[model samples]
Every structure is written in C-alpha cells, then in structure tokens.
Target chain A: MSALVTGATGFLGRRLVRLLREDGLQVTCLVRPSSDIEPLRQAVGDALWSGVDVRTVELMDENGCREALLGCSVVYHLAAGLSGSTSTLFLNSVIPTRRLMAASVSAGVQRFVLVSSLGVYGTQTLPPGTVLDERSPVDPHPHLRDPYTFSKVVQERVAWDAYKASGLPLVVVRPGVIIGPGRGVLSSRVGLRLGPLMVRMGGGQQLPYTYVDNCAAAVRQAGLAERAEGQVFNVVDDDLPTAKELLRLCRKAGAGVKSAWVPRPLVQPLAGAYEWYHHWSRGQLPGVITRYRTAAMWKPLQYVNDKAKAGLPWRPEVPFDEAFRRSLTIAPAIG
Target chain B: MTTSPSDMIRVALVGCGQIADAHLQEIRKIPSAETVAVCDVHQDFADQAAARFEVPRAFDDMQRMLSEASPDVVHLTTPAHTHCRLATELLQAGVHVYVEKPFTVDVREAEAVLEAAHAEDRSVCLGHDQLFDPSWVQCRAMVQAGAVGDVTHVESVLGYPFSGQFGRQVATDRNHWVRKLPGGLFQNTISHPLYRITEFLTDDRPALHANWFAGSADVSIPTELVAHFRGEQVTGNLLFSTRIEPQRITRVYGTHGALEVDLDAQLVRRSRQNRLPGAFEKLEMPLRHCREATGNLCRNVWRFLKSDIHYFAGMRCLFEEFYASVRSGSPPPIPYEGMLRVTRLMEAMFEQCREREEAGDTAPRHSQERIKVESDHTIKSDQRSNQRPVTTNRDESRELQEAWS
Candidate 1:
C-alpha cells in the first residue's frame, strides 16, 4: 500500500513515517522547501521524499495534491502551524486541512488520518472527582489565544466537518502535550532549563503533560486500524501525576531543579502590569512576569485515552518518568 | 494581682536539653522576664539546671511547673514528636506556647493544637528562628524589591553527619524521632533553612516534590536528602543530610544574578558586580540582638543567645498576639491557616517517604541481620577474607559519578 504523509520532518510526523515504512508501506513524505532533512534522514533513512507546499501547490488545478494522493491508499495529514498571529491559525490550520481533505476525496484516498491536539479540549482545570475523556466538552476559553491550539481546534473541526459531509473515513488523534525522546516543546525548552532551581507553578498539583512516542504510537494505530474510522481519540498514558510529581521526575532524570508554587494572586497583578507596560512602551517591556503568569501551563488538564486503547490496540511504549528523562537528551537540530 | 512591667512575662523552661541553656541565658538578659521554673523528663537534669541558673523552682512534671510558676510563656525545647501534645496542653491552660522545629511530627496534630489555641483564644508559635535572621530578612527585602531580577531558583543544603552529641537514647531507639521523621534531615534540620529561604524569596508558599534515598541509613545516620520545591515563578532544591560532614549552604538564583549564604560562616555572597562595602564584613560579625536587648550581645557572649531567644520569641509573639486577640478581639500573626498550609507540606513529605520505602527503593540499610561467628578464629578469618581493598582515589571518583549517572 502507498501512503502520503505531511510534516514527515516534524517530531511526530517523522516517527509516523518510520512506523508506516516499518509496517511495509511505501511512504511518501511531503516536506517543506526549507525544512532541514538531516533529522528526517536520520529517522527514516532515505524514504521517498517530496518537497511541496500543500496550499500553494495548485493541487486541484494542476492535480499536485491529487497526484500525490493518487497512488496512495491512505493520507496522513500531520502538518499544522504551531504558532503565529491569531488569524494565522484559521488560514494555516483550517484552510489547509480543508484543502487536503478535498484533495484526498478527489484522489479516492481510502482512509484519512488527521493529527489533532488535546489542547482542542482547551485549558482544563479538571474538577476534583472528574476526569476528561473524548466525550468531555472542549473548553471555550478561545484556546489561550494561542495560535498552536487555535489552529489545532480549527484543523480538527475541518477534518470532522469534511468527513461528515463527504462520508469519508476519518480518524482524528488528539495527543496530550507530546513528550518523547528529544521531541515536543516541553522537552526542548522546559526540560533543558530544569535544574535544582525551578519555580513550580501553584503547588505544582495541576497536571499538564504529554509523551511523544506514546502519542506517535496512538497516531500510527489510528492510521492502520479500521476500528479508528469515525473516532476521535485522546492519546495519553496512565500514572499521570500532579505538576509537582512531574517536576520530581525531571529532577530524578538529572534536571535536579527545584519546583516552587507561586500564588496566582501575586503573579496576576504582575501579568496585568506587564501587558500594560508592553502596550505603553510599544512592546518594549520584557514581559517576564506577565508571560509566566498568563501561561497556564501548570494548570490541571486530565485526559482519558481509553477510547484510543480499546479501539486502536495502542499502548504507551515508555513510562512517563522514563520518557521525561529521555526527553532531556533529545537535542533539536538547530538551523 | 496585677504585676509590674518588670515582672509581666514570667517564663518556664521545659525539656532542659542543650537548647534550654540558650533560652535561659536569653531570659536572664531580658529585663521584664525571669525563668521562674525549669522542667525536664529527668528530675536530676531539672535540678541541675535550676541550681545552675539559680532558679527557685524545678520539676519533672510539666503540669506542676506550669501551675506553680504560672509562666506567661512556656519554652518547649523537647523533641519534635512531642511538641504538638505538650503545646496543645499548655495552650489550653491559657499559657502562651512556643514549640521547637518540625512544629509537629504530623499536621493533623498540629492542626489540633491550632484548634485548641483558637478555642482557648491563646497564642502559639513555632521555633523557626531563621525567619528573623538579619541577613535572611535583608535578602528577602532585596528580592521583593527586585534586586535579583525575578528570583527564579533557590538551592539550599544543610548537610552534616549526625551530631557527635546526639546521645545514647537516640542511638539505641531504632524508631527514634531523628531516624524515623518523615524527611529526616530535610525535615528536622533543613526545614529551618528552607522555610527561612522561601519566606525571603517569595510571598507565595511552595508545593514540595521530594525524591530521597537512604544515603547512609546503614551507618545509623540519615542519608543524603534532596527536595524540589516549586512556587508560581520560582523553583528550588533543598538538599540535606546527616551523613555528609558539616556543610550549610543556600543559593538563590535569579534572572539577573544569584545570592548565596553559608550559614556556618555566616557569609552572604552576591554574584552581582557592585556590592556594599561592609556587607561581607558585617556578616562575619556576630548577630546583635541575641536576647531581645537593644545593644550588641554578640561580643559579650561570643555567640547569639537569641538563637534560643529567637526560638522562644516565636512563642512570645504567638502568645502576645493571642493575648491581644483575647483581650482586644484581634487575630494572631501565626494564624491557623498558615499553619495548615505548612502542615499539608509536612504531610506530603511524609507520604513521599512512605511511598519511596514501600517501593523498596529506600529500605533501611541496617535492617539486615548481622551474621554471628562461632569463634574468634572464624571471625578473624571471615574479616580478613571479606575485606575488599578500597579502590584508589581516581577510580573511586569515576565510580561515584558512574553510579550517580
């Protein structure tokens, strides 16, 4: 079987490409013109690579997207803009996904897999006695006004809407903050900076997390399994601990950092003051306090991934603590 | 019977250990107070202290001492495990109570004392004296003023071998307070410096996540203790031990620079370029208000008596606040809410320790039964054969790193 994958150079996308290739499928990776191919090469070792922009490629007019989709029986769309201006989310995620779905339909691709985010469930401070599952309502807080989450939500909605209207086989995978060996934002920025001194946000009880390899495995399972069609899975592992426990894991993994909880009330004013200063100074303000306070990364958001497990036959390969430790050694290829 | 200002604060010394001497000396220095009575679990010890300090009253029973002396404040210098029970009973009897560190072995008991204090409308204070240290207070003020731009991290270590003088009672008891405390050194000793350090850095209280291993529990000493504490904008590690030989250090890393304190030497080091001329020199000088007096007591005593004074002052402050609240309808400074938060943290540490032990990763090293030899000839042969030569320094260092890695 032939498969076409977008974002094949990305952390998750690269992993997916390898898994599909290992499964004996002819994988064609759609890469950006500018993405460094070294890591992807390291990951997939000379898989058939295609360089093209999905939106600009006159896929329908010149049949470029359709051509890529032609021989491929399955289409895996994983690429999405993580951050930019608010409007960029709509343009980058929603539009491109719609275009890809349309192109897949025209090319008669048998199955479609779309990678979404647990962020689409939005910023959840899961109440005591309740755990979030796929059926839980998405938070309406406008995705933290973050382009990454906004784009993800739009992307999922587009895939869902298109699948409903066109009766196409679609599987949407929403993975909690993806963490793995040298992948994901937390591993890249947060893990590297962790050490003996780390200020834990608010008693570090709130849960905000993901593991990369586990999420990738879930995505791969969804792509291959017929049971995953028409399903949306929240991919997370068990033994999810409070933020404080996560920090302890980081410390054990040699991050050796301290975690302190800052009271919200004290930091809230500092955030407001930072925003005001930024506005008054025309964005000259450093916004350190404001950035720390506004970023609700420490808040609890528990997700249940039983649906993914039950349907996709997926299980997390690495435990959370082991994955966290491995994340420290994952050096990103800096361009 | 209204008393003059000179006799207003009558004090009783409870648990006459090494710390009680410091408290008695401080009381001698305070003009309005006198140590009317001394109590110890051992009658001889109480008699010795009463005679040495020229006190009129001494008792083995705490209740007898409290009733006869009618002390306005009771200085609790007992082991941490007993602080809650004694403090609760004393507070309920309308005596302002001061308890030593660890405040209580458990939070629930600490809460019970606070509840009792509330019911009786009396004052209670924990002996966390590092909070009042001038250097710490100064450091706190600077961080609050943005001296080290947005204090992000703090590291504290209060590590040392078990004191040479910890005594036979502690040595013999397997489940003694020192050996069995939730976090061992992290609680019994490091908590003093940790609480003080956090109090200085942020107004926000921290949630603690600790991973501890039994470093030398086999040697009948507590192991290397490490804890990570997180606040909203700050994170810190508290590393402590009763095995590592005499080391006291604390470092606070901020965005711009770092501030470190060496408690043993009483030195404060700042990483920033321009510093005050006498800042380091001033730290070398002994602490001045040792016994609540206005003048320099550091020179007279060569040691600060207020270490105990500071310890007892917490109780005094707790009592003064409680008395004011009862008389004028106000709240105490060391409020129950604050104590509750501290208790929760204490409970978490205990839970983490129990969890680690249950996982079998932190089993006591000394729990293994020693093999008995049939005779001296057999014992000598076994000792000689079993003695593996110690690795040279270079190989030892490499092996240590590899083990940790």
Candidate 2:
C-alpha cells in the first residue's frame, strides 16, 4: 500500500509518516513549499530518512494539490492554518481541504483521514458532571468562534462536503492538545518567564489532552480501520486529568512549576468580562479570561474516547503520566 | 526592601533593548529620580548597560533585581507581546510601569495591565512618543485652539527607508516578533500614525477599509498600506510604506482650515481661505507660504539650540510627565480610556487589512455597525451545534498559553 500525508512536517504528520513506513508501506510526504523540514527530519532519524520521498504543493493550487496525491492509496490531510482572521482560516483550512479531497478522490485514494481538532466543540462548558463523547454533538459556541476554532469547524464541514459529494471515505480525528516531544504548551512558554507556578483557571475542570504519539497512532488507525469511514472520534488520554492534577504533574516533570487553583465562582466574573472584551475587540485581543475557556477548565467532567477505542485498534497505549514524563525528560523546557 | 518617603524615586530599567538607552538617558536627569539598577535577560547586556550608565546594580534576573533594588518605578521597554504578562506582574508588585508602544499586543492585554494597575493602585504609562513630541505638541494645541477649525479628516503617513541594520534585520528575520503580530510590518511601524488619527476621532466603534500592496511582485510581504477609517465624528487615512524616503506627515483637514505637520522636520504649516477676490487669494497664498517657511526655519533652529529636536526628547518629556502623575496622584499621562480607543483603532486597521487579504469573492462583505451585530453564517449546520459549549486547545498548544491569574 502507498500513503501520502499533507502537513508531513508538522508534529503528528512526522509520527504518522514514520508509522506507515514502519508498517512496510511506501510513504510520500506532501509539504508546503516553505515548510520547515527540520522537525520532520528530527522526528524520523537518519536511518528512515533516506527512503522517504518528498513532494511540494501549494494548498490553494487545485492542480498542484491533485498532482501531489498521485499514486497514493491512502491520503492523510493533517495541515491547517492554526492562526489568522476568519477569512485567513477559511482560505488556509477549508479551501485547501476541498482541493485536497477532490484531488484524492480523482487519484482513486481509498481512505482519507482529516486530522481535525477537538476544539470544534468550541469552549465546551458542560454542567458540573457531564461527560463528553462521540455522541456529544460537535457544537462550538458562537461567542467562542475565533478563526482557529471557526476554521476547524468549517474544515470539518468541507471534508464532509467532499465525502458526500465524491464518497471520499473521510474519517475525522479530533485530537486534544497533542503534547509531544520537543513541543509542549506549558514548557515552550519558558522563554516568556511565566515563573514556576501554573494557575488552574476556574479551579480545575477536566482538560481533554492527548499525547502526540497516541494521537498519531489513532490517526494511523483511522486511515486503516474499515469501520472508521464517515466517523469522527475525540482522541484523548485514557485517565482524564483535572486541570489541578495536570499542573501538579507538570511540577513533577522537572519543570519546577507549582499549582494554584482559583475557585470557580471567583473566576467566572473575570472570564465573563474577558468574553465581552474579546467580542468588542472583534476577536483581535484574546483575554486571559474567557467564559468559554473558564467553562472548559471548570466543567468537572472527563472526555470519553470510546468511539476511537471500540472502532479502531488504537488505544491509549502510553499513559498520560508516562508519556508526559518521557517527553519532559527528553527536553524539559522544549517539551 | 523599602524606600524612605524623602528619598528619590528609585527606578530600575528592564529589557536593555534599543529603547532602554533612551529611558536611561532621560531617567537620570529627573531630580527626584535615581537609577538604582538595570536588568535584561542577557547578563552582558545588563552589566554593560549598568556600567555604561553608571548605575549601582545589574542583574539578569527580574525578581532578584526587584527584590534587591526595591525600585518604585520599572521601565518596561520590552517588545509589545511581553507587555501584558510583565506589566501585570510589575503592577502586582506595586511598582509604577512605563511600557513601550503599541502598549500591549491587543486590547485585552492592555486591559489586563490596566486592571492590574487599578487593582494594585499603580501607575502605567504608554510610550506614545508622538503625544509628547514638541512639534506634535504644538500641532495638537493648535488643533485644540481651532487653528484647523472642526477637524473632519486626517491623513497620517510615514515613509521608511529600509537601508539600515535594524531595517535589514526586520526585512530578513522571519522569527521577528513584528512578523508574528497580526499586521506584520504595519504592526511594527504604524502605531504612531494610528494614534495620530485615533486621537482626533471619538471612541465609537469605527468602520474601517484597509488595503495593502507590496513594493514588487517578488516581495510578498506588504510594504505599503492605506487604511481608510470612519469614526463617529471624523474620518482618516493611515498610510505606511517602506519604499519611500523617511518622513512622518500628519495632515488634518477641517471646515475652516488645514494643518500639515512634518514630524521629522519638526514643522507645522497651516492654510486658510483668503476670503478675498480670486487674484488676491492667489497673492495671499504665496505670502502665507513664505511666512510659514520662515517660521518653520526659526522654530527648527530654536528647538535645536534648546536640544528639543534630538531623538527621544519626546520620550524624555513623556517620562517626566509620567513621573509628575506618579508623584501628584493625578490621572495617567496617557488616559486609560483614550489608550483603549487607540488600541481599538489600531486593531481595527489590522483587521481590515487581514480581512481584505483572506476574504475572497464569496465571503460576505464585512458590514460596519456599532457593538454586537449578530454575526450571520453562510454555512448551515445542525441547530443543536449552535448550542454547543466552547471547547479550546484542539490542535494548537501555542495559543493555549495561560495568562497568569
């Protein structure tokens, strides 16, 4: 079998490419013309590097996108513009997906996996004890519609659009914040001198976090699993950690960061003020507090990743604690 | 560490960048001010700055400097992005803060600092140098005095010559903080012009139309922009370009007259209708021009003699005013409300530019209205999805950095 991956230079793309190669399949990497290939090379060391084939395509160029998917039986689209205004998000994400999907369908690709984000749910502020699962509608709050989330929502729509139009056999994997080697939310902020204490917004709700390798494995499985076609899975850790516990673990990971949680009641008003400001600013200025982010961090619930577990062979093989520990051990600040 | 009430206002400088030297140069001249320490992330920069400026202490660590120096004021001359976190931290520590421009990266960050300052009852000064520039001060006074009648429109333009080392750095460095900002080149350089026009406009939600173009087909990064704006009572255009000779010109058009300010030359020219016969009007214009030319020369020479025309002199004046407010318990040198208004305008301009770039033929034209127009959607989804709660941090860890509560 042959596999082609867009966003092959990104965090997950690198791992998935290696996974395919390890499975003894020919893998081709389709990257943007100017993408930094260093991370990809670092992810797959020298031995596997020589056999890898590379192709460059402009996402917006329909012909180029089509040409890039040639000779691949399975196509994985993992690239999306993570930032910019609403229009920028649409251009970078939705438009590219449409072009890529059309191209993949024409090239007779059997499976297409869209590496979507769990953020498509917007800032999910469920009731205190509500657990979210695949049955939970992929709903995003109106007020929480920044370009990043809005783009993801639209990109998923585009993928489904292609699926319905061309029967492209699309599977979407909405991964949580993918904590991986040489990259981490908490630690990359070291340069900002955030100091050694992490504050839990809204006194500790469940954060839907997934380690990078687990997410990659799930994505690889999504492409291979016959049952995953036309399905969406929320890829997250097995033992969902509370915001408070996560920070405590962060401290133990040689980060030397401690934890402080502000009671939910006290933080709610501040988050509301920030939401108002974000709208008034027209999504230009992001506030430290957002009602959406506050709700997510204080929801007092865990995410259920049952769909991916049941339908696909991929499980949370690496526990969050071990994965996190190993990641920090390799690169304390970078990860 | 503590300070006596009778002692000079202890001050420490942070982030020994290009602007830190300006603060150090001016800060030392204040009678009640004492430059107790200087600090930077780089030790050599801190040590060299402290030694060069004859400061008594130097430290690479911020907390240690704050702990050891116990300075009443900390000048934050760091990049725009760092303002929110660092300023909030300083404000919590109960130190007066003087931050360099664009104030904070966005309005919320600006509000964050203000909230912290209000919470701690500390002072925060924005490094809006034009607000204190001698030529700008004179022009502003004239505008207030009706030298330009009822101001209706403004054209604020700045030209940059990308020929210097710093210019080359901005041109080449892909990882530059300016490149990371929303407006890219405009974010780095357009604050002055944005504030110039924003000052003349009201705080009502503005309607903006901005378009940008690069110098050549090979240059993809925008080096030129035209931001047309409509506020409640005024309209303005902010023009910026790197292809032109260096000049800062802010012209105000009014019902009765016009005021043209040359910021680089420290000159202001005013024009009014002669209200005479046609031939007499033609004669009056040149006479007015000649008189204005002589006045400009005189003003320039006088300012040079008095050292008011030197670089960063406005910064010095602004700092002195900030100190006055800190000592007298008065309103901030830059009104918090006005600063917000300026930030709004700046962000609006960036939004317009980005909107034009990404918005193609299909997207609905951005409508201009006041607060909270219900955003209409083009793509339909299940109605249940509308009620879905907000979920963040899907694929992006970079945007998930928590602002310390």
Candidate 3:
C-alpha cells in the first residue's frame, strides 16, 4: 500500500516518514517548494516528492495535493507549525489541516492520521488534580489565545467533522510535550543554557511530557492499526515528572548547568511587568510574557497511553533518562 | 621529606602578575616555605611585590634570582610562551618548578621542560590547584567510591561573560600574551577545569579527539571551544567559552545515578540519606545544604586562617611537595607527562584553526588580537610574514635536543 506524508522535513514528520518506509510502504512526501530537501532525503530515501503549499487551496485546486494523495492508501498529516505561538498555530495548524483533510477526501484516501496536541485542553489555570484525557471537554478560555492550541482544537474538530460527513476513517493522536533527538526547539533555545530558574504557574507541579520517539511510534501505530479508526489516543509516557523533576533530569543528563528557582508568585507579576515594559517601549506586544507564563508551566498534565497500548500494539522502547539524554544532544542553533 | 616548620624551604616567585599574588598568598600560609625573592622581566613589578610581601630580595633576571636567592623551589607564573624556557632554566639549576595551567604554549615546549627536569633528577608540578580544592576532592571521592555508580559520560562547561579584563590587557600593549596566545580562552582559562576533570575521571589518561568552532563575532578573543574525548569506558565533552553569561558547571552521568557540580556555587549534588521530620528518607541533596556554598567555603577557609603566617603555612605544605620532590628525586603530584598531554591537546586545537584558515574557511568571528593593544596597533599582525624564516642554528638545536633527551 502507498502512504503520503506531509511535513516530511519537520521533526515529527521526519520520524513518521522513516517508520512508513521501514514498513515497506510506497511513500510519497508533499513538501513546500522551498523546504530544505537534505533532511528529508536523509530521513526517507528520495521518493516521490511533490511541492505544494498546504495553506494555499490553489495548490489543492490544481490537483497537486490530490495527485500526491491519489494512489496512497493512507495519508499522515504530521506537519504543523510548532513555534509555541498563537498566530503560528492558526496559520499552520488550523488552516493547513483543514486544507489537507479536504484534499485527502478529494483524492479518496482510505485513512487519515491527524497529529494533534494536548494543548487543546487549554487548562491554563488547571487545579492540581486535573488529569487530561480524550474524554475531557474542549474548555479553552476566552483569553486562552494561543494560536497553536486553538488551531489544534479546531483541526481536531475538523477531522471529526470530516469523519462524520464522509466516513473517512480518521485517527486523531494527541501528544504531550514531544522531546527527542535530531531537532527540537526546547533543546536549541531554552535547554542549552540556564537563563532563569522558574517554576510553572503554580510551583511547576503540572505538565506531562512524551518522548518524541514514543510519540512517533504512537502515530505509526495509529496509521497502521485497523482498530484506531475514528478513535483519539492521548500519547504519553507512564512517568509524569513535574517541571522541577525535568530540571533535575536535565542536570542528570549532562546539561552541566545550575538553575536558581524564582518563586511562582514573583514570576507572574515580574513577567507581566516585563511584558508591559517591552510593549510600552517598543509600541508592540512582546511575546516574552507568554513565554514566561508558559515557563511557569504548572498544571499536572498526566495521560494514559493505554488505548494506544491495547489497540495498536505499541510500546515505548526508550526509557525516560535515555530520552532526556537525546533531548540535550541537539543544541539548537540560537542567535 | 621529613623537614619541619623552622627548616623552611626557600622559594622564588616568578612572573609577578595577578596570579602571582594568589600563589604568594598561598605560599605565606605554608610555614615550611618562605618566598625569599621575586623575579620578573619588569623590575618595578618585582621590586614592588618584594617590598609588599616583605621579601628580602628582588631580581629582574630569573637566572640572577636562581643563583643569588638559591631558592629550593621556583614558582613559575610567567605567560604561556615563556613558561618552558624559564622553568627549564630553573630545573637545570637544581630548583623544583611549579608552572601555572597550560604549562606551556605547545607540547614541544612542555616536553622540553619535562626532559630538563628528568635530566636534573628534579620534579615539576603544573599549578592546577582546582584538582586539590576541597569541593572537587569531595566530589571525586564520591565518584571513586561508586556512590554514583560507574560513570558513563561527563560534560564540563566553564564560561563567564566576557569581563574585558584579558581583552583590556590585550588592547593595551601591557600584555600582548593574550593576543598571541593560541586557542584563546580555552587555553588560558578552561584548561584548568578541563585538566581537573580529566584527572578526576580517569585512572589512566584518556585520549582526547576534538572538533572546534569559533563563536560568531570577532572580539579579539575566542567566545567558545568544544572538545570531545573518550576513554575505554567513558566518553565526554568539554565546552569552554567566555561568551556565556552563566556560571560554570560540570556534570557526570553514571549508571545508577548522577553527580553535578556548580562551580560558581561550589555546590555538589548526589543521592544521599536525609533525615526528615517523620521518616528516614533516602534523597538526593546538594552539598552544604545552602544556596551560597562557594562563598561560604571561601569565608570559612579565611576564618580558619587567623593570620598571614597561618595561611602561608598551609600553602607551604603544597609548595614543599614540589621542593622535596626536587631534592629527593621523586615525582611531583601533577607529573610533567600529564602536563605535556594537556599541552598537546591544546596545540591540536590551534592546528585545527590554522587548517580551517588555510582552507579559506570564514575567518573565526572573534579576532584573537582585537582586544589587545598590540593587535589594534599592528593591524593584521597574524597574517603570514614573507620575511625569511629564522633557521635554528646547530647550537640552539643541540641545546633543545639535550633539554628534551
């Protein structure tokens, strides 16, 4: 069977392409015309490569997207802009997925795998005991204006809508903080050096992380396993380490840096003031406040990957320490 | 070796620079040693230091200081380029030598110093006191004891925001050494921590294979140098830079657990037993259990030394080891061979840079000479000179051969 992969140059997309190739499927990659081809060629051998912009329906209209997806038995939509920004989420996640789903339907693709995020829960101020699962309602706050999260929520909704309308056998995978080797923004930007020690919004007790390899394995499983059709799985690891635990783990994994903790109460106000100052001085809103608020990442985001385990026969082979080590090895090029 | 406090070993302080003060301060704390004389190329620096330290003699020439002062030990604190020749001269004259970090600019020079010491049946100790620091000692002990299990890898990073101290020195003609020095910050500062790490981790020395990249700006100094090394069992990476604003840290990854040291804080973390209120808890904890451990340790060490004599007496203990080894024909604590190995590694890094330049690679961002006065005064001084290369005469060649052999 043939499979078409979008965003094959991206961190997750690259991993999915490798898995699909290993499974001996005739793989086709739909890439932007300007995307770097070296990383794609390295991940998946030179295969059928088509250039088309996911955002422009003109490309879809010209049947370029459809042509790529035509012979593919399954389509994996794993490309999403993950800059941790609101606008990027809308442009990359929401709009692109909508376009890709419509094109997949037009091409009569049998199965579609929609890569979603745990951020869609949008519990910015979740209480301590909240455990987010697939059953959790979409309760995004009015002020919860992260474009990426909004897009993921909307994209997942669109996938469900497509599933309802045409019976397009769709599987949605919601992954937590995906970390692994090769390329990750976390390792490149914040992970390489110690800036300021911080706790999540409430003492850094919240947040769950999934190893990148594990997330990829889950996506691979969702794409191939028959039972995963029309189902959503929260793909994460068993261990639920808090932000402080993550810091300790990084140090253990040879980050070779010490962090000084800033009290949670002090962070919010200080971050607000810095944001205000940056905004007033520059006459433009600075994203620093949002970055800092994300830094205060406390909201216990625990998940059970039991559905993936039971239905897809997938298991996370990488232990936490090894995954953490791989996360540090990629030092992102930071200016 | 059995000498007592009253039978003090006479020592000469060479290269009366900033670090010389620290060495002298440490020496004064040693009751078994006395700084009998101070020597420097600059007469004023030597004279002023001798007067301040209350030493009896001062000399502009090191040869004069060695003969006149008859020092049992010579503390070599000169710049990297001059360390070998000066230390060799002192060793040949029957004086034990303690040279500072990156004992020489090149492996050839280091080997010459070792050969001279071996010919004279004396010992040379490179001044890498970080290995002897109490915090490092404790951390090494824990690793040796298998407290953290078998170490698989180690990452060492030493950095500080460019304070412009060395740059300012280079900018002024005061010390052109910083400008001419190879590998810049890595060779000058990071060598200490890197050497200390190698010493701590290995029973047998490891072979270091390194790839280097210059930071993206020409500030007349290097912003970063990264080296990856491996032993039979362990592989490690050393990142040295002056561009990073954060404090220094070193981490060792092991099978069972891990150990991290915050050099700026002088703090260590390892798994240990902790007594909580209700239950006996086995927990991981940082040393000293306080935030400012490094500052606290420094203050405590000062408080322990009630007077200059007390402090100097303690330093003399370290000095006497070099002195007694020279006198009794024993090996120094930090052997000359180990010093040569580190020097060679440093040379290899420079060779990489030259190779890159010859290949027409983009010039490294930081101008090694920019921060120095000499570089500013003489533009493009590093450009290859077309003047006839000075061919070494047979006599000088023979002298070098004799020194190494």
lDDT of 1 by residue, A54-146 (tens): 222421132567766777888888877665433333434665677778888887788899988776763444553356678876645543334
Which candidate tops TM-score?
2
Write candidate 3's Cα lDDT for A164-220 as tens digits.
997888998888777776443232112223364332343355345678778888888
Q: After superposition, which runs of candidate 2 have C-alpha atoms over 4 Å from their true positions? A: A122-125, A140-143, A185-198, A258-260, A276-293, A332-335, B1-405
TM-score of every candidate's chain A? 0.80, 0.88, 0.80
The DockQ assigned to candidate 3 is 0.01
User: Candidate 2 on B105-223: residue-level lDDT in tens?
Assistant: 78888888999999999999888888788888898999999897899999999887666434554665555577788777777678888888877876467788877767655555777
- The residue ranges of model 3 lying beyond 4 angstroms of the native Cα positions read A1-335, B1-6, B171-175, B200-218, B271-317, B324-329, B360-405
- Order of candidates by TM-score, top first? 2, 3, 1
* Residue-level error in angstroms, candidate 1, position A30: 83
* Best-to-worst ranking by lDDT: 2, 3, 1
Q: Report how far off residue A266 is in candidate 1 (Å).
A: 64
How much TM-score does chain B earn in each model?
A: 0.71, 0.84, 0.74
DockQ winner between 1 and 2, please give it.
2
Instruction: Show model 1 residue runs off by greater than 4 Å.
Output: A1-335, B1-3, B167-175, B180-186, B200-207, B273-335, B362-405
DockQ of each: 0.00, 0.01, 0.01
Quote the positional error of residue B25 for candidate 3 in Å.
0.8
Residue lDDT tens for model 2, A163-244: 9988989988999878866765452111112455555555356667788889999999988998778898889988867666
Whichever of 2 and 3 has more lDDT, that candidate is 2
